[model samples]
Structure formats: structure tokens, C-alpha cells
Target chain A: MVDQVHKEFRRRDLLYSGALWLLSLIIPDPQLHYRREYRFRKRDLFYLLTILLLPLIWSDPHFHHIMVLGGIHGILALGLTLFLGYAGQISLGQAAFFGIGAYTTAVLTTRYGLPSFLAFWASALTAFLFAYLIGRPILKLKGYFLALATLGFGEIFLVMVRESPRLTGGVIGIFDIPFFSFAGFIFDTYLKQYYLIWGVLMGLVLFSKNLIRSKMGRAFLAVAASEDGASAVGIDVSRIKLGVFVIGAAFAGLAGSLFASVMSTANPETFSLNLSVLIVMMVILGGMGNLYGPIAGAIFLTYLIDELSRYQEYSLPIYGVILILLLIFFPDGIGTRLRIRLIYLISYWGRKRRREKVEL
Target chain B: MFLSVEEIVKHYDGVMALNRISLQVRKGTVKGLMGPNGAGKSTLFHLISGMERPDSGKIFFKKRDITGLQTYEISRLGVGRTFQTLQIFGNMTVVENVLTGMHSRIRGGFLSSGLYLPQIKKSEEIAIKEAKEILELLGLFGRWKWFASQLSYGEQRRLEIARGLAAKPDLLLLDEPAAGLTYPEAKQLAQTLSRLKEAGLTLFLIEHHMGMVMEIADEVAVLNNGELLAEGPPDMVKKDPGVIEAYAPRR
Candidate 1:
């Protein structure tokens, strides 16, 4: 009898969990869709079906463009999220790294007449080196100090891009940059660009997701929380900080290269301090420290800006209002709030079902 | 000797934290270091743990000179320590925090661990099992999944000990394990210490609670004003006039 009861309880738990997993698949939770739900929880067959069908739906030209831009922004946001969210390092120089990748790709393809494919990898490498050198001293400082240093870095990169005419083509920008090609297939249309960007984004997301669950990722979290405590437990806080910074910047650089290739241009206006601020805002508005939060922030901000272009005079005010509301209502960010609500609902329903079964 | 510290001197802006402090611990023996506050107990612990390097000293662990070695390297040499102020990964669950203590045991790098390779998975499973067992031993198994910060003050202190124990170190240095515990809690901690001693673990502890220390400590060394005042068996050290005088109420 006891064995039967225990078995029944286990069966019920499995059933309930299965149902919740199924429900999560159908629900369109913009914030919790990626990180908490899909990443950690076991997805049902329907979710797997949807994943396979997503590429087919993106075959349209307009949809493909939106998808490509989304992919680039997603990669950039994910990279920044790792540093600002998980590792607790604030970086306002992400656009600087992005600009570096763009210029590097442009100069290599247009000025040096190099293949666009090689330029992408070169851009990533250059960004990594730049981050390593700059991050060493800046990462040593915390909070406001670190922010100030990165801000200075952003401004310096912007100025350099503006002043260097021969190298960067100044404000008018570098054009006639070669398009990205993979295995001799040039990414000429929105459809090709979508597939290319999506492929890169997927690789980054998977790599970063795996990285967070590793020992190195735990060391980063430990250092972020308390440097002295982390040291006491045998973690090299400085090295971990530098490692995340470089990796994050590399991701930004990759996004920049893609952006440059898609537009066939590199310009100072494209990598402004305002763009850096926008990236930071996206990270914050989505949720700081959450892996998927930035994706939601990026998508929402992008679509909102695109839609708000109808009222050019009122767009800024509307954007400010939305940000203020998000800050006041869901301070932990939409991702965390949605996760908490889902967990609460699940547990509540579980208890109600238990009560009904007991009554029967 | 498994570990030795010789003529360690530390000065913070001419304020002597440790003046010619020296100690040794052999394999398979527990050593106690008792000292009043500002008597350089923590400073000495820091020096041994490699949190800070002494101005002049030689520290040897397992016959290897470890002077100026990093904290992580010192820990890797099988010298684990607990903080006087509770140090724990607050954001992580209790089990995760304990697994962190077993970090050095897992040889696989980030990629292997991240990919969850067969060997890495096996190691992680064993680590979780060992961590669970440690928590059970400390009577914290029920709350294993709770965040470390959610634990009560006494539980947090015990969690710190559990984390240190999970490292499976040859020598464990505990700094004031019973610092803020109630009398009953202190008594329970004494029992835990006795249990650990029976397991043949070498423990070097700094404590101010004389009652608890005398109960579990086989040998005691007392420090006052950055100098060793007494070192002997618990009974002898308890009755020593110098030990009593050093701890007596200051007017």
C-alpha cells in the first residue's frame, strides 16, 4: 500500500511537470522564452516542431531582414549580458568593439582587398586583443570607476573613427565593402544574411550557455559577488574578470562585422556613444544578470523603435515612459518577473490538484 | 612536519600584527591556536592561507616551501580554511556551495565541464553525492537546495565548516568556528570537532571560547599581543597563569 502511494505520487509529479512543460511551449512569453524555460526545462515535441519550422517561416524577404537584424542584436546583447549581468562588470565600450569589428572588416575587404570571410574572424581577434589590453586596468576598478573608464574608451574610439579619414573614411563612411560568403555562397539577399546571422547567433548562444554552467563561469559569479571571498576559495578574480571581458567584446565585434557586411558600410555615426547607451539600456530593461533578458530587451526595443518612427516628435518621450514603467513595475526585469510568476502558478495549481485528489 | 611556519613577522604601518610567530603541525595530529582579539589570530591565519604574505617568514606545506604562493595554490596544496567572518557563495544553493569546495578535485577544464562529458558527469555526480553526505553529516541535508544566504546565522557558520570539510584537505584551519554561537550551539560544535578528530583529520583552530576549545583540543597554543604566551596540553594550558592573565578582563 505504501509503495502504491509513493508510486502514485511520483506519477502525478511527472504528469504535472509534463503538462507545465507542454504549456510553456504554447505560451508566448517573450522574456522567459529562451533562458529559463527553454534552456533549463525539458521541451515537449511541439516545441521541437516549432524550432524546426522557425527557419521556414523566415523565408520571406522582409521577415528575413528582421530576423537578420534580430540575430545580430541578440548576439551583441548576449555578450554584454555575460559581462554586465553574470560577471557584474559594466561596459559602455561594447559599441567601440563593434565599431572596431566593422572598421576592421571594411578596411580588410575594401582597402586591403581581402576576402570578407577572413575579415570577420580577424575582426573578432582584433576585438579580443583590444578588450584584453583595455580590460586589464579598467576591470580592476569597480562600479562607477569601471563605467567611467569604459565611457572614456567609447569616446576615444568614436573620436578616432571621426578623425581618421584615410583609414576609416571619416563621417561619410567606407562603402563598397565585400559581402560575406560561406563556401562560395555570397550572402547577397536578406534570406542569406538571415541564415548566416542566425547560424552565428545560435553558436554564440550555445557556447555562452555552456560556458555559464562550467567551473570558470562559477568562478566569475563568485568573483562578481565578492572578490575577497572568491580568493579565499581559490578563484583568481582578476583573470576571470579579464577572460569574460575579452569574450564579451569578441561577441560584440562579431556582431559589428556582420552589421558592416550587411550594410556594405563602416561609419563613425554607426558606432556612437548613443548606441552604447542603447545596448546598456537593453541589458538593464530586459534584466541585468539574466542570460535571456537582453534578447527580450533587444527585440522589444528594436520593434518599438521601428513602430514609433510614425510619430517622430513623440518617439523619445514614449520610449522614456516605457522604460520608466518597466523600471518601476518589473525592476528585476521582465524575464525574472515572468519566471517567478510561472513558478508560483505551477506550485499553486499543483497544490489545488492535490487537494482535489485528496477529497476524491 | 606536514606544515611549518618559522619567524613569521607582519607589520601594518609599524603596528606589529605578528612578531616572530612560529608554529608546526605534524601529520595526523590536531593543533589549536588560541588568542584574544587583535592578538594576530586572524593575521596568522591569513598568513598561513596565503591571503597575505608575511614581511619575513618561511611557510612549508608538505615539505614544499609555500611562502608567497597564491591563496588558491596554497589551498591546492591540501590546506583548507574557514573564515572568522562567514564566507559562503550566497547566490548559490547550499549543495552548489559545497560542490565549489570540491572544485580542485575536478580536473576537467571549462570545455569538458561545460559539455558534460562522461568523465565530467561522473565526477559531478560523485561531487554532489559527497556534498549531500557532508550536509547530512552536518544535519543540513533537508535544506540542501536552499540558497546559502537563506540559512540562519548558526547554520551559515556550520555551512562554512561543511564547505571547508568538502575540500577533503589534509589539514583544515578553522578560524573561530564557535565565535557567535549560543552556549548550546557551541557545545554542539564541540561535539562536531570531537567527531572530526576521531576521523583522524588534522585541525588547526583559533578560538576565544575557552570552554569549547579545552573540551575538544588535544594541544593548545595561546597568543597575546602578537606573541605566544603558552603552548601545551589543554589542562596545562588552561591552568597556566600566562594564559589566564592574557584572557583576563582588561581594566
Candidate 2:
């Protein structure tokens, strides 16, 4: 849900800000693995700098609201990327966890008189519990079968929401959910909420990035490559996969809580297959395996959707065309692939400039 | 005996892959496993490494029964192995593939890893130092950043050795380490194995390349049709009539 932006200007710079946010989140590699083990990574330092500075300069409530949604989606996509990208597992049940979190926030704050902060954690816990219970049996299935299992899970959650009219508000959905607050400070407006959401998202981003640089992270990739090979190296493949799945579920739940607080509603329709597919599209178009790519994908898609909404009915088909175009050009996601292309261009220019200087 | 395999029998769909196969390996010595095709060479390695349970048998390492334990558990108990067909995590970096091999050696699980705790960083720094040393040993130090898949065939083979070595296993079981290497590469691998032996590491290897195996193996065990045909000093095993009949150059 975004505030209306009728300013007579193209938001190209905003799109770049998102792209740059993703581009700087690149490379936890080679240098960190060996020689300079203790030094602060320049890329990470710049990335954090970018996260804080961007919101201050862009003082549009509409842009802020849109980004608040983007941040929430960023969290969801990041979670999915860990399972799909890092651990080589897929899940279409992400929205089920999201719906649970949103409803938990809605029910607890409105009925139980619990704070939204407490409800946020409760959401994560409930999602984690569901993922653990279900992941044990369904995680054994691989490839498309696993996707089907997760899809079934999403459908089952929708049925439960519909059937439990007394608790979940049934067809009308829960409303008047209080604004997200920590201690006494309230995230009341889109600007304040933007910081709240991005703040949480940034912390998660750093945590995930750090995770991918460690021993367990390698185990995820190893499992992704080959379960037998991973086991041979003494990597506990099942535990690794299950852990990623549960963590991913927890992340989705957290995002859902944020969504409920910001939008002040919990509805069954929002957590449908379309939302799950859109999140998947973000990861695919942004990039998989690495965190920034998905976040970038989230940010990019948020703006595109905002702009295209003006066309109303035509937006859906336009979305399809754009996705195909992005994938055809950037098959591995635009973040890393575009960065690589940029690096090549820079090096080429550097050489050309040197030649010109020599000729002079 | 430092490592002992007692009558490991394995069946896949009612066909015996390993039938009552047994052998012993002394500490700090290279024990060679030789067999013809379908002679159950890799199956013996798989059972010992805990990839699959033996139909009935036991494997002891450092005086503990490791049979049927999880592969990682077996690895933690100082048993490491490579594959006949390469099992490298190709998309991962060379160092990451080896770092995965060091899984049991390092101790950062979800909580510590997610938080990026100080102790975890300390351990990671140590692990990276050690991992680099392993890569250097395999001549993959320069290209440590390269994706495992991008490496050439022989480089990937050596990368697997580098990975297996990262576990610091007391008993390393290599299944055809020289399977795809050229003559020079095989000779180089033989030297590396000898160096490892000289450093007091124990090795159990299955090799079809008799020259490399004969040069480095302290003792040899020959299997034909899932049963040990001969076991003795390399020179004596080569001379045995049974080995000559099964593993001879001509069919």
C-alpha cells in the first residue's frame, strides 16, 4: 500500500537508488576467505552507507511508502533466496507463513492487547514451528515435487483462514491493527515506518551476508551441489536444508507482521499464489544465491509496479512482458550479472583512456 | 591394525556389490585396494565412509566401531574419503569446497553464524589459514577464488584431494585419486601421497593404476568379484597368481 505520488517527474533516480543498493551488496568473496581476514569490507561499508543516506534525501511520503512495501518484500525475497538460492531448495508456501504472521499481529494486537513488537516475534515463532513440523516430511522431496508440496501447503492455509471465521474475521479480514511500535516509540507515518522496515531489513541483510561467508554457508552450497558429496565431507545435509527452510519461514513471518502493522489489515486474498509467484519473480529477476540481487529485484519491481498501476487493467500483461525481457537480458538476475558487465566496461574504458593519454 | 574392515557385504537390488570383503590398514601407512571392474572397489569405500550401511559387517577406526554411522559422524571420527566419480561442489569456490570438507573441524552453527560472533570470526580466520595451506598443498592456492566448476578436469581432481585433506582425517580413503590424471600428474600425486605418509597420516586408497599404487602403498589388498584375492607386500601381491589372473593387463 503506497501513498499517491502525482509529482510531474520520472522516478528514474529512485530506480537507480534501488539498483545501486543491490550492486553494492555484492562480493563476500576471495578477499574475506584469505589474506585480510579482520579488515572491514569496503563494499559492505559502502552498502550500509547507501542504506542510511538514501531515505533522508528522498523526502517523498509516496516514495517512502512504496519503499516500505519494498523493504517488506525484500525480507520475503531474502528468505526465499536462502532456501532456493543458497541451499538449492524451493518453496511456494512462503505466503502461508506471511499470512500467519499478518493474522497473528492482527489477532494479538486487536484481541489479546499485545504490542505489535511482541506480535512480530510471535509471528516468527509460529512460522518457524510450522516449517519445522512440515519441513521434516516434505523437505525429503526434491525438485518440482518439493515445489508442489509447498504449493499445497499455501492452499491449505487459505482454507484454514476461510474456515476459521471466529478467529481470522473470515471473508472480511482483520482491520485496525495498531501501528508497529518498539517500546514507546511509534512508527506512525510512512516515513517513520519506512525506517522501521528498512532498519529491520538491513540487519537481516547483514546477518545473511555474514552467514554465507561462514562454514555453515559453505555446507549449504555443498548440499546444493550434491547431497552425497556434502555427506561425504561430513556436512549434515538434512540439518542444513531444514535449518535454511525454518529460517526462511521465520523471515517470511516477520515480514508478514510488518505488513499487517503498516497496512493495518490481514486478508486471505493477499497471501494467495499470486503473491508467492511475485516473490519468486523478484528473486529470479533480482538474482538468487546472493542477498542483494533479491532485494534489488524487490526494489526494482516495487517501482515498476507503482508506475504501471496507472495503466490499470493493462499492468498484468505488461508485468509478464517486462519479466521475460529482464530474464532474457539478465538470466542470472540483473544485480550480479549487470555488475560484471559494468566491471568489464570500466576496465575497457580504463584501458582506452590510458591509450589516449599515451598518444597525447 | 589402526583401521579394520570386517566382512563388509552390501547388496543393491539383490545383486551383491561387496560380498564378505575384509581388509586391515596399519596407522601411518598407505594401504592399497585393487580390483577389476564391478569388483566392488568403490562400494567398499562407500560402506567405510558411511554413505550406505553394509548388509552385515563392521568398520573400526582408532578402536571405535564406525559402521553405519552418518558420513559426517564417521568423518568427525577421523575417517575421510573421496569419490571415484568426482563429487566436488562445482559452483562453489575452490576454498569453499575445501572449507566444507573442514565442516567437522570448524564449529559455527546457525546461531553463531547468524550473529557473526567474535569467536566464530576467530575460528573462521583460523580455518581460512588452514584451508589456504591445504589448497597450496594441492597447487590450487593461486586459483582459490575460481569457481570449482571452472577448473580444468585434472585441477578439479586435485581440488577433490585438497578438499579431502582439509578434514585432517587420520585415515584418508581415496577412491581412484589418479583416475583421470595424465602420467605426470599421477606421478605428482604419488609424491604427494608419500609426503602425506611421511607426515604420519594413514591412507587407504583404491587405484586401478598399478604403477602409482605399487610405488606408494605400504601394503596391498586385491579383490576380485567382491572377495579378497591376495593381501601382502606390494611386490608379493603383484607376484601372486590370483592377482595376475584378475588384474592382469590382458583380458
Candidate 3:
């Protein structure tokens, strides 16, 4: 009886996979032909539609809060993508820069009573300087060694935040941080913070798009492709690496500043290894080497974690299982895989309609 | 002399890669360096291009000692090269690959580039025009939009040369430009090299195609066991006993 049941199960599994294969082969993926064209169009539409409809669709404060968090994570992922995806450098300690940004804003606003506008720029500058100082040494290492060194930096930042009671408010962290304000307009509510973060994300995205399409961006691609070729073509490889690293850190810093202001708090726990890994995950899950991959990844993961919170104690384990299964199927990214599948389905339906018309 | 190498020696873990190699080439001449497997043609190229520093030697380009300068510095001083392995950017379009080679000439800092300033746009327009011209010059104009990886082996080899030429280099170091080309493709590459020579660009090449090398090389240097065995015109170098013995060893 056991042998009979196992045989039946195997037969069913084979049939299911065979059917999937046939369906895939019959349909066609348009992404292979128009990948770049679709990305450019879809990205513009996504930003436009969100800006127009987000306020009406997500009026609730809780939804707004989630959107705000998603926007901040989006910024962080964008920066990480430039370093990891574009420049082909792996940084596992991105949260360290985020932490520095948050801490800078928190300390500056709470202790020194600096204005929000000034504090925001100061936070980014501080993170940029930090990245520049350490990048020269750390950027020398490649691949996994670079990843580990960055992770170490993140851990060091976490420890510093925890230990420096008088400076960073210790484990309890800084509280009552002021809201981000421009001139006289204050972003005090979740609704305002949502628009603020998303607005900044849009600007940064445009800047990133321009940067990626420029001569310097080509140099980055060349460097990533081959160091010897890049140098042969007159690119200062080390300088480009360092520049991208600092720029990524600066983005993370800006995101951190916004995050601290929105939450009105800065805590060591918020910028831990878990957050660093999550940001990296967002970049990978969205897609590497593409501009909006990180944004798509950030929103998906932010919503996923939020939705999975209903599982209570089992939330993380279930999430882990889903992530692993998804990764196994779509190693390139969820966006690319979904785009291909969607295109295939549409083409399949179109072909079926044409065949029916011909028979008639 | 446009470029000269003097007693350059290199060793890797006590294995001598280049043993006191010396050579010179006049301006606008095609110099060919040929040797058997592991005869240090690549090592010599690396030393001259500043990819690797020589243990004890000096290199002069345009009469300036450039033995230990960084690769980018040497490249900026007009030393361009192509890899033995095709290093074309696989994802980027053909024109984009050549535009990458224009990195030294294009002038724009991060802010100007990020903002897409007027001057930067002008420079970019000029670069695109120049890159397209390069593609046209190499007979790859129709495939300008295709990705580098999509091109055939011969086209990719030509694309690599196009990228090197885009740097506007006074001298180009080509490492095995005809490595995987068909006979016709190799002949076409030789024609292109001859045209480049006529246009006043000095060429330093390491090729295994004896026919192609002998037909086009203004000067040929033969390396045997990491040492220069013969240096003369192609016919004279081919007739040298040491050069003949280096290719076919006695059992």
C-alpha cells in the first residue's frame, strides 16, 4: 500500500510540473523583447498614479504610517542599490549610515536645538563624511570580504549607540525629536510625513535615474564589468567605488533623518543588523542593476512584514519560508519574474482568442 | 621614439615572467610582439600599461618615465589597451561601450552629471556622435543598439578595438585582437589596423596569427623564455635561428 501511494504522489507531481511547463512554452514573455521600455513606462506611471490616488485610497493614519515607513525604506534601498546593484559593491552595514543619520538629527534637534532644515543637511553630510573616511580602506576589499567589513561597521555603530548614554541616549534612545520642517511648514502628522518622504524619494529617484544614464554611470558599469577594462578606459576605479559608497551612505542618512523625525525617536534597535539585512533583502528582492527594483522590493517587504504580523509568534518563521520559496523560483527578482509571467499570460489569452476567431 | 621599455623584469613567486626585456617603437608604427605559450607577452604589456609594476626597469611614453604610475594615470596620458579576454560590457549597448571609453575626455563632476547640466549634455551629445562614428568606422553601425554580448566573436573583438580607439589614444596596446576570429575576420582586422596606422595611431599588438602579424607589423620582436630573442623587421625576425627554435622545441 505504501509503494502504491508513493507512486501515485510522484505521478501527480510529474503531471503538475509538466502542465506548467507546457503552459509556459505555449505562452511567450514580452519582457525579453521590451524590458527597458516597459520599466521606463511603468516607473513613470507608478509614481504618477501613487501621487494622485494614495491620499484618497489610504486616508487612515495607520495606512499613512505604513506608507511613510515604506517610503523611508525605499530611500534606503535606492542607496543600497547604487552601491550593490550599480557599482557592484556589497555593503552589509548600510544600517550603520542610517543610524548615524538618525542619531545626528536626534542629537542635533534635542540637544543643540538646531532647526529641522539645517539638521537634515547636517545629518546627510555627517554620514557622507563617515562613509568617505572609512570607504577608502573598506572599498579596497571585494565581494564577501567587503560584505563582512560593512557588517562589522554596522555592529560597531549599534554598540556605540547603546554605550554612549550621554550622547545617543543609551539603550533607552532619544525621544521627542522635532518634525521635519521646510521654512515654516511642519510635517507633523503621518499624512504630511508620507508626502514629505515620498516627495524626497521621487526627487532622489530622478537624480538616480539621471546619474545612471550619464557618462559617470557608464563608468560605474564598466568598473563593475571588469576592473582591468575600466582602468584601461581611463576610469579611476578606486575613486568611483569610494564615490558611490559615500553617495549611498548619504542617501541612507537622509532616509534615517526622515525616519527619526517621523517617529519622533531614535533607537539603536531600529538600526540593527536585522534592518541592514532587510534593506539588502529589499534591493535583491526587487531586482539588482535596475533603478526601481529596490523601491518595489521595499514596498513589498514593508507590506509583507506588516501583513504577516497577524501570525504573532510564528510570523517570522512563516515569512522566512515564503522568502526562501520565492527566491528559489525567482532568483533574478520578483518584479522580473512577475512581469514575464504576466506577459506570458496575456499573450496566451490573445493567441487563444485569435485561434477561436480563425476556427469560426 | 614614441615609447620605450628598458630592462623590465618581473617575477611571480620566484618564477621569472619577464627577464630583462627591452624594446622600442617609433611613432605611428605597428609593433608586433610574438612568443610561445608562457613567453611573457602579456606580462610585458601589463608592465608597460601600469597594470603591474616591473621589479627593476623603467618605461617611457612620450619621453616621460611612467613605470609605476597608476593604470588610469597612464591611460589619461594616452595609453589605451584591450584585454586578451573580451571585456566588453555585456549589458550595455555597443555605442555605450565606446562611450565608456570616452571617460577621460568627458568632463563633468557628480553634481553636473546628476543635474544634467547644459555643458554636460553638450559633452554627452559629442560623445554619442563620436561613439557612433567609431562604430561606423568599424562597420558595426547597423548593430549600434545591440548589446555587446549579442555580437559575434569577431564583432566583439572589433568592438573592443573600437572602445580602445574611442579613448582617442595616441598608442593602443591590443592583446590578441584576432584570438577567435575566422580567416576573413582576421584579414579584416589587419586591414583596420593598417588604416589606423595610416591615420597616425601607433599600434602595439600581440597576435598568434603569424601570417597577419608578418604582413602588417612594421617591427616584430620575438620572445623566448621571457627574453627578447630577436628584434627586427618581420622577415628578418622570422629568419632568426633563435626565433625559429623558440616555436618548435627539440625533443
Candidate 4:
């Protein structure tokens, strides 16, 4: 009897999903309705409120430090999503851009005695220049060839940083990097640093949200969908690719500059092929092509890594298995899957309530 | 002539795809290209649109030499084209696909766009308004927000043309726009094409449906084995011996 009841329930669930799918097809959900009417979404408001209240609720310095790291990773992933996700290009050397930024900040602030504020912008400029120089040639490649080419670039950056001790401190890394300060106020406390990183992140998020809906964003989507079609529509495919690459590099650079100051170090080990792969993994896991997906992925992975530390050496294997499972189930990304599930749940309840009313 | 191709030649490996093909498109007229398989109709379109540079030839649009220009450069010169295969951005909504075609017409810097400056917002509003109009013209206004991939095959073809038209091109190149359309859809497409011609838009298309081509095309050019066989009014081309022989099925 119990088995039969379970089967009936399963059948009802399948029927509900099928009806929902069909309904979705007939009257397509106009996702922009809210954006057109209301400037802010409920989810956006929720995230803002949570971010605003997090400091008061989470007073632990260790948690604050980890969250700061998550914010940095969020920046890196956000930049990379523009290149790897939006432009539909493969990049395995984004960490090189990150390294370039960190080193630029490190060298300028330590050697030239530049202020952190000036060094931050300089780091972005240096990374942009580096991306532009290499992007012209590298961006021409597609698929695995592009991935390999970027990986090679990252390896070259690693070797150069390690070999140049006088400039980059030779793996021991640059130290005593001054904290980020603005107009005589120093971000000396953990709370200050947390706000500092999150503030930058929020600004970038807002900027990216606006960009993804703009004309250039449309061009990026066109290129990503079909290069031939994009060119046919008067969008310079190569130029767009190069532009996204440079922009992604600039973002990485900004994050790296903040990272150098926050962590008070610039080391070759921090920006490695492993870290590059980790960033890519974060993008894949968090979801590609959405603004918040990569950020969520970064935080999730950061927390996961921290929690898995108790597993000692076995943590790596466990983490790999979990990633494989995540990809299998939510290949589109956790954010998209969750969004779809939420819609389905709401529609299912609506249908059930309507059926109950009809029966009455 | 609004557009002219002079002795265009294109080769792939050891095979010649287009052999010294030259054609002219008069302003505000519908010109149809009819050809057998491997007759290089699509190849000629690609060359004209700058998808690939012809091995040798000169193409002029509005009397400007556009032979060596890039595809986007050619497009910016008021040339819009739809591919033989559907090139719709499947993930994007139908309206967004059309809006993307209006890329060159709207001007806003990266910073301005990212910050959603007032000028950028105005441009975006205009873009949406224009896109909706184009979609309505294509009979896709109701489905503007639908994903391009989810549209029916006929709608997808119409969406491609809608996207091409959204660019406000002086010369539009359509490759096999009615290949998968139902009879009614093809008729609708023909009507749309006629309306576009009446609106003073020049159309150059490649098609296999002779009935639709003969009915809609002001002039038709027939190609056989990568060579232009005949060019004349659709009625005269229909009676041409070479054109019939090229299209006739082999037993």
C-alpha cells in the first residue's frame, strides 16, 4: 500500500512538471517584465540587505577574513566570466592577469613609493596593456588551441615572476604592502577590509549588470552565439573579443591590487596554473553568463575549501567528486538551476491550488 | 546600380566555388539568384558580404571599393546578410537578436553603457522601440520575447530576416530564407519581401523555390556549375533553356 502511494505521488509530480513545461512553452515567461517595471528585484534587495547585515551578525574575524578572500575570488571570476562565458572564449591564463595586477601594485607601492590608490589604477592599466599586447595574437585562436595558448601564457608569467627576484621578490613575495586607505582614513580593521572588498565587489556587480543589458553586451552575445552572424551585423568580432579580454584583465588587475594590500604579499604561488584552474572551476560551478553566478561559486568554493581542510590530504579527492556531481546535476550553474526549481515550485503550487478549488 | 561585383573569383582547396561571377543589383529592386547545388550562390553572397575575400575581384557598394574590407566593415557600409544556415543567437530573445543587429547605429562608450548614462538609456529605449517595430513588421511582435531557438522553423527564418532588417541596411542579402517554411509561410515571406521592395529596400536573395522567386523577384540570375548562365526578368529566365536544364533532375 505504501509503495503504491509513493508511485502515485511520483506520477503526480511528473504530471505537474510536464504541465508546467508545456505552459511555459505556450505563454513564454517574459523575464524582463520586472526589470521594465521595477528597477530593483526582490532577490537583489535580499542580497543587499544580507550584505548590509552580515558584519553585525558574523563578528568572527576568521570568518571575515575568509569572506574577504571570497570577495577577491568573486572579482576574479566576474572578470573571467566576461571572457570565458560571455564572449564564448576559453581562457586558462586569467591568473596571469591577476599576477600582473598584484605585481604592478607591489612593485609600484614598494619600489616607487606610490600610494595604494594610485597603484590600484596603475595595476589595472598594466594588466590592460599586457592583455592588449598578447590578446591580439592569442584571441585569434579558438577552442582547445585557445585554452592551451592561454595556459602557456600563464606558465610564462609564472616563470618570469619566479626568475625575477629583484623585481618580484623571487617567490618569497613582496611584503609590508600598505593597507588601502582613502582621504586619510585607513582600512586597518577586519571590518574595514571586509567592507572595502565587498564595496568594490558591489560596484563591479552594478556596473556589470548595466553592461550586460547594453549595446556592447548585445554585441558580446552576438559574437558568442555566432561569429559570422555578429560580423554580418556590423559587430567587429575580433575587436569585441579583444575588448572583453582586456576588460577581464583589468578587473583581475584591480582584484590583484586589492589582494596584494589586503594579504600584504605578492607571491608567484598565489597566481599559478592551479589557481587559474580553480578560478575556471568556480566559473563553471557558479554558472557562466550570469553576474551573480560566479560570485556565488566563489563563495561556495571558498567555504568548501575551508571546511574541507579537516579532511587533510583526502579533501582534494572529495572536492573533485562533489564538483563532478554538481556539474552532472546543475551543469547550467547552481543559480540557474535554483531559479528554475523555484519557478517550478511556484507554478506547481498554483496548479495544485487551482485543482483543489475546482474539486470544491 | 547600388551594388556591383566585378569578375569575382573564389576557390576552396583545388575546387573553384565562384568562377569570375559578376552581378549587379539595382537600387530598390528585388534580385533573386537561382542556382543548382554547388552553383556557388551562397559563395557569391559570402564574397559580397565579406565573409571571405574573393581570390580576385572588386566589389563596390555605393561606388565604394569594398572588396578587401572585413565583414563588419562591409556591414557598416550598409550591407546586411543572413546566412544559409540560421545564425540566430538561440539563447537570446527574438527582440534582443534584432536589437543586436542595430549595434553600429547606436553609439555609447563602454563606461557610459556600464554606468547606464542618460544618453545610453535614451539610445536603449530607441533601440527597443525600433526592434519591436521590426519584429512587428516580421509578424513576430507577439513572440518578440521568446527565445529564438524555441520559435518554429518558419518563425526562425523570419527572425533571421528581421534581425538583418533591424540593421537598417541599404542592401540586404538573404540566403535561402524559405528553405524550411510551410507554403503559407513562404507566401507570407514573399509578401513581406515585396513590401520591403516597395519601401525602397534593395533585396538580393538566393532561393530554390522557383515559384516564389519568379513571383517576387524583379530580376533573376541563374547559375550552373559556378558560372552565371542567364540574367533577365523572371519570366524570361523561366523560359531560358540553360536555366531549365540546370534545375532539371537527373534520371
Q: Please, what is the TM-score per model?
A: 0.87, 0.90, 0.93, 0.92
CA lDDT of every candidate: 0.81, 0.85, 0.87, 0.87
Q: How accurate is candidate 4 locally (lDDT)?
A: 0.87
In order of listing, the candidates' clash counts read: 1, 1, 0, 0
Model 2 CAPRI quality: medium
Q: Candidate 1's C-alpha lDDT?
A: 0.81
Ranking by DockQ: 4, 2, 3, 1
Return the lDDT, model 4, position A302.
92
lDDT of candidate 1 over A175-198, digit per residue (tens): 988889867889998877877887
The digit string of per-residue lDDT tens for model 2 on A193-240 reads 988998899888877877787787788888888888888888888889
Task: Indicate whether candidate 1 or candidate 4 has the larger lDDT.
Answer: 4
Q: What is each candidate's DockQ, to 2 decimals?
A: 0.35, 0.64, 0.61, 0.65
lDDT of 2 at B158: 90
Which pairs clash inside model 3? none
- After superposition, which runs of candidate 3 have C-alpha atoms over 4 Å from their true positions? A1-46
Best by TM-score: 3
**Regions of candidate 4 where Cα sits further than 4 Å from its true position:** A1-39, A342-360, B249-251
